[model samples]
Target: MALIFLYIHVLCLWLCSSTYNAQNVFFQPSFLVTRGPSVTALLYGNSSNIILILQTTSPSNVTGSFDPPSCVPEETRWVLTSELIAKTTVQVKLRLNRSLRLCGNNETDTDCCVNPLCVRETLQVSACEGNNSQASLIVQVKVYARLVSGNMVFDNKTIIQNQVYRPLGECPCDLTFKTCDLWCCCDEDCSTEDFQLFKYHCLPGPFGGQFPDPEYQCSVQSSQNSPDWFPFLCVISPPGNNPYLGLFYQGNKIAPKPGMSFGASVSSPPTLLDAYIEGSPILTLKDQYFTIPRTLNGYCVTSAPVAFLKNFDVKCVTPLQACPTEPPLQTIPEDLRAVVKNGVGGNAVVDVTDQLATELNDFITSSESFGSSAVVCENVPLALDYNFYWKENGISGITLTRTLGTVTLNGNVSLTTRYSAKFLSGDITSKPNSGNPGYQVGRPVIGGILNTSIGNDSLLIERSPMHLWKPVNCGLCSHADVRPVLFGENSTSGCLLPVSQLNLTQCGLLRDTVNSLQDGLVEASLVAINGHPNAVTMADWLNISYVTLNSSGVGDSNSSCSNIPAHLQIYVWTLVTGFVDEIPQKDIKAVEISYSLSSWKLECGGGDPVCIDPAETQRLPVTSSVTFIDIPLNTGPPKNRYQINFTEYDCNRNDICWPELAFPFTRFYTGEPYSQALAKGIILVFFFIVASVLGTPWRQIRQIWSTI
Candidate 1:
């Protein structure tokens, strides 16, 4: 059992060894520090051993020392087992023993020192073994300083590329070390030359040595291919952190215009004009101050009553001026009144003279009695003047005439006559004459002595005869004829002679001549008559001449005369009297005339024809003793008549004509009396009153009964 145990133990040991050897190994604090400030290192091994070291290309101040001489071994190693696997991670703390300081000169510290020194460092290890081996386990370290001078302290460990670090010691005030001069230091006492060298000379710093100068001159080329210089620079630092900087230069110091910059210079974006970027303000620097140039021009615009530049830079222009207004238009006045003309009594009679004569003539002739009277004659001797007499009858049957003298008449008595007469010549005559018995009486004287004693009174006789006759006379008869006569007598012959006067006695002969003369006189004296009322008045004898001449023929000495007594048996006549006598005469009796009268006719008899009295009946005498009877006529009866004489008549001599006795007829009738008409009206009124009174009460009763 002991021998078997021993062999088993040996096998188990071998297996453990082999398994541990196969496990993976890892390192912590992969970067080793050869600088200030120590870092802890860890080893992750699963049953495997791990070892590490720190290396650097930087030189140490101590010369002739081991490459990574173990002053305090800058790396650590570890091994792990199954029983302790949970605690397999081991920490190798690197407490830097910074008591040792770097000497500026390499001659005094030619041996490797045993103290820690700060330097910029890196940490690395050999390739890891077993399972998945890693060769990139490295760490870099940077160091700050308490004191630094001209010489730079390099790390003993190797560093990787692109690592950044600060120097490990305090910087000297006036030292001019190349790498140290280029390093950035927090201390103000450090020379700025080093910071400036990195700032301006480096690739992308603002003030590197290769950067363009602040005073550098540039030309803005108008090339289509080139991007806009100002806008491109604006995009670079849009907040205007360095607005003065133009494109492709440092410290150009350009600025945007007031009210033009973006964000900073202007709280808002500038108002855009015309194009998106063409009118933007260009930034420039003058005397280290920012300014903007108003360089671009743009389009013009109109704003109604004013024209102004818009979409363009109008830095100092006003925008509210107006154009002039046109003058007020002239107008003409309009006509207002209507046309008018003068009128006759407001009548529009443009010409008045044409109708004056006719109007005057009509006015004069339209009087009530124009040309009415045939003649104007007074009471005069019928022989001295022509008598124009009008019969007292109606207008239809009337005559006119003229007579010659008081004793003998021969004149025209025509239907219309005012006869004109003129005395021409005449012979005188006596009524009778006696002759003598002279010679026979002497012979008988002897025997007659006895008879002479018987008789013989001296006959004393005066025979002076004078004849008077009418020159012209119109016969007062129905025939229209006139005669002019001359009468004479011879005593010895004892014969009466008659002779006709010489005159034209036709109806119109003398009248025509006289009227012609009168018309001529009147016409000739019109102006004088108008001036003087009594100027040469023409006599009305022309009317008489017309009557005589129109009724008689021309008389001559040899013309036969009428066989009538002179101055005692002649009369004037007219034909119209005969014409009237020839008309049929109606003998109207007094009773017939009275009965035919219309005044006695009944006007009303309750709508009936009037009754008439018989022609032969006499009116009854109406006396005080007679009593009137009350007749009860029938309703709607035919008319009746009654006549009674109320006045007395006279049966007188022939010279006194009296009216015949006739009855006075009265039209009378009885109707429904006033009492009856009143009774009927009252009955109608009573019926209406009863209707009004009973109807309302009945309606009320009906309403009351209906409600029950």
Candidate 2:
């Protein structure tokens, strides 16, 4: 490239002066970026140099005359004309000096500039500098396309475009402007590699920045007002309700598990989590906290705070691609969700998980009461303990959902409590201070609300803080409505939706979804305790009072002014399908399985998550996705097929779903093997028909249906 430049510089300098008979230097038809259909310009130059600027404004053509330097004062007249050949390509023509003939404009043109009489000059277009979209705005005429020319010098072996001619233009709404050029940056592209915002892509433009946020504007254009189209579909929803991103399970807020931690992982050994976290469980809620791991529609928010207050407030992450946002949030793997069952695992974070262990102790004591000798969950803490006595067998599940597409996973974890802590029942007030009853209940904090004012679709989830309880105070939270609004937190007169008690509902749901594995916790803990087989029926279960979204009530100091939106009427129910494995042989662990039907976000990391453009309520009659998740913890993904279903307001579409069954019933020829069999059968039938018509094989007609 450097050598090319050297050659160009030498050739161009030689062409300008070598005693040319025509005394002419004209750039060949060059590719120029013209804002409008036409361009005109004037020229002035001496024998030593020539200054010419091509432009588009009013009159048809631009003509001018300049004298020769170090020679005659009376000069040559040059005409410049321009035309737009393509959207961004242009052709400029220069007509000059017919009288000052280089070789007298005849065959005997020996007085050429460099070597031979024939010279082909060419100029290449470099790049776009700038253009104007508004006529009223007085902006400096900027340089749009640059022109670089090189001569096909007779003796020079290489032709290099070394000379650069850049013309600065003033662009307005159209060609009527005094100087400005009119152009549009509708190329359907912007390099987000540097930043999501592109200056030419209407970012901080002359018009007020139409982009609410870089993630919104730069993402797939989803609104009418949001530039007609964009490079990709975007899913920057408001912070979703807690970790599941406001997704509910089996028609109720999933009871937060006592000590389960959740995160995302894609690598093998599966132990290396992408973004894992655990939080305090509100009171005794079984699965209320963010326990089950599943791919969120957008990006992952830090489990640090569960929800967001407003759009203006800074967010650590968004719902979709977790880019272009402030204070980086953990990048939760969107492909697989990992729930370390024993309790949120001991992976980096400690404060939240420790508190949950205490709360779990409180819950077990309340349930067992210690009156009878059979103490079930009395001494168990979800954390790592030498005497915890937790064991994990092999577990696995396959998710048939939109986001993950289709993922299958299998693993085993074991957690056992080594020590038992004694506690008195009904001593809540004695243990903690007054005014706040369950305030000390290890509860996960939910931040950021979900907004769905725009782009509400069947497969697209638009989460907003507005959906949550709004705070009484904007700046500081004096009172805020936190997630898991418990059974009696909302008054009949104050908040619209009253908290619904789901204690029995929680245990029952678990029983229905997790009992397929004969060796899992449900069996070991009840049906077969300590190698003793005992039939524990549903009748033996106790009616437990688990907190819903109304967790921790509201902070005592902030209780008086709880953010009503965060604390009030927002609700979501989901159907999750996955597998659970419990292996206590070597290590103690709990396996969790879950899956979603539709994408919570428009884009699911891939180019498109849908076969057809998702309609608000329009239903796709027959498109199926088979998701596969590969997880090898040294332990392979379980062979059993499992799934779960949950739903709420699914765009009023038919909530039709296929139940997640627990068997490899489809392990046969349902796929390619079936297709091959089908083809062979068709060929056989065709041959039989031909044979029958031709006069043979009639004996085998009825026998084919029976057997060989």
Candidate 3:
């Protein structure tokens, strides 16, 4: 067997635990850039008293712009931040209801009635430092149109391979020549320039103009291949481990040593998240440590506005350094903390409870096929089953408390790992089966009775029946497309990819939520797997030495864990209050308390249920929520080092490694016409056969037949 050295970290929750960008934002309703403010709140604009209500208009046709809050009052205020460089141009934040809105009282006056902010001009506004010159505070109301690439969405923060940030060329709205080049929608009057990909970069536009491009670099972490019993690496540490008593793998169910613990929740996660997006952040992300329910000791995490609430608060500090490993953890911005404590205003907990549950069910139910080559448990395919819920924390300090359930570890496991008994030397087989599956290699997984208490939410999954599709008549291809189809030269079908729009992640899984069927996953199928278990064939063909394989295969196994990964990897997502010792290396790390970036809360007149009205009534207080997408990243990027000159991304520089996404979709190859090609082949074969038969003289044939 191959000697393999593993450096896997075992998280102890109590002992351990476990634990971007905006681009083409407008066409995408939930683009990250559109979700949060790029700059921190400039509490004091250049001019404070000269309160100028930026009467900006947000509409569907606007490109490079964020979608405005729905049904909001016609006006919204803008802010300038000290964090940003001096003199930044500001854009309008309001989406205009052209037909319903009345900008002013003059119905007949076109200028007063129509939406004021123009899309053509840059939204960038100069500082309003209450300057003597009116020019300092001058704001432009330009008309713009949408010139978008529905398929070509770009992200500035997340860099992806082959997804280089190409410079976007603007149509150059030539006001001088109303008759310009690119097709576009202009103001009621053709006074502004046409809108094209412009200079609003998430990173410094190395290529010039702003590259509001979006990309993700999915570092293909190690992945087990052709797993025999499904893989599980216990963080013998806290948050990462789920308590399980016995592992039912390949016929053998191995129990953990007495007193030793194992098995984690194959369901809900321990940590939860809540983020506030869509404008300048009222809440800033910071480092924080909170106590776990079981122990007085707590784990520290860099918060996403609210990974921990006041419920877990201890002594607090400021400007958290590094990832939390110290004591007396600091807190996130205080104002944001207050909001979460209050919960009566805009959404406090961006809850994604339902989504996480759905994700959990999907992962738990999903399975991988078994193969003999996979001798080690790490060699098998594994799925993470983590579920969580967010609602009232049961405590008044927090508006909503995120109660996490168990985190499930599931995958397809073989019944009994088989090998050619011929090669089994009495010496190797001399050792007991160890009563463990994949024991020939290192013992990858063990189960034990957990000491912790089990609640109603605890999920105990035993064994699931393994069903492999076989051909009954014509071939397995004749079977329904219900199960994942394999791909190959003889393959009848694989996953079929549907046409899809560009996603915020850019290169990672392109899941189409509205129509789950057409997701990019449907475009490919797991036709074949790579990696070999280094087996040597000897002169005695029957006897082969099974050498262990080193390093994990190249695949998206880690990423598939994300509920997303890469720019923001989800090392561990929990639904319950679990423990984690260390965090993987990534920019944004998060744990949820009572929120999901996807959570929605309606704020009309505070949390007053009475302010709500009938949908039909104008007086019906607007059901409002900052339209947000709970991406793996829920909070805004850190403000400390925003740049004038953007740095190139790892993917752009080809400096990072990426995992291969198991063929998630079906594919079709279009080539030579079958009928015509077959006819040609037949003709060639027919001529050759005829020539051969004729080549033999009749007399020689007769003689040969007689001899026979």
lDDT of 1 by residue, 377-415 (tens): 222112111111111110111111222111111121111
List the lowest-lDDT window of 10 residues for candidate 2. 132-141
Q: Write the per-residue lDDT of candidate 3 for residues 597-653, one digit (tens) a residue.
A: 121122345555423432211110101111111225434455344232443422344
lDDT of each: 0.27, 0.25, 0.25
Cα-based RMSD of candidate 1? 68.5
Per-residue lDDT of candidate 2, residues 1-708 (tens digit): 999999999998787656343433332322233332123322111212332342222212445321111211222233444554544333444443222212222344433322212222221211111231110101112121211112213233222221222111111121221111112122222122212223354323322212233344344354665654444554455422213222211122234445655876446655522222222221112333422211234433333221111011111211221112221111123321333223223311111112223122211112222333431222222221111111132111112111111111112112211211111212222211111211111221111112335454422111111111222222122222323222112211111211112211233332222122111111111110111111222222112121232222233231021212221121211111232342221110211222111111122235442323332211111111111122324543543432113333222344542331311223334545755666776788799888786664555665685686
Number of the predicted model whose lDDT against the real structure is largest: 1
* Candidate 1 ranges beyond 4 A from true positions: 1-21, 28-37, 46-86, 99-708
TM-score of every prediction relative to native: 0.16, 0.13, 0.14
Model 1 has an lDDT value of 0.27
Q: Which candidate is the best by TM-score?
A: 1
Model 3 spans > 4 angstroms off: 1-135, 141-143, 148-708
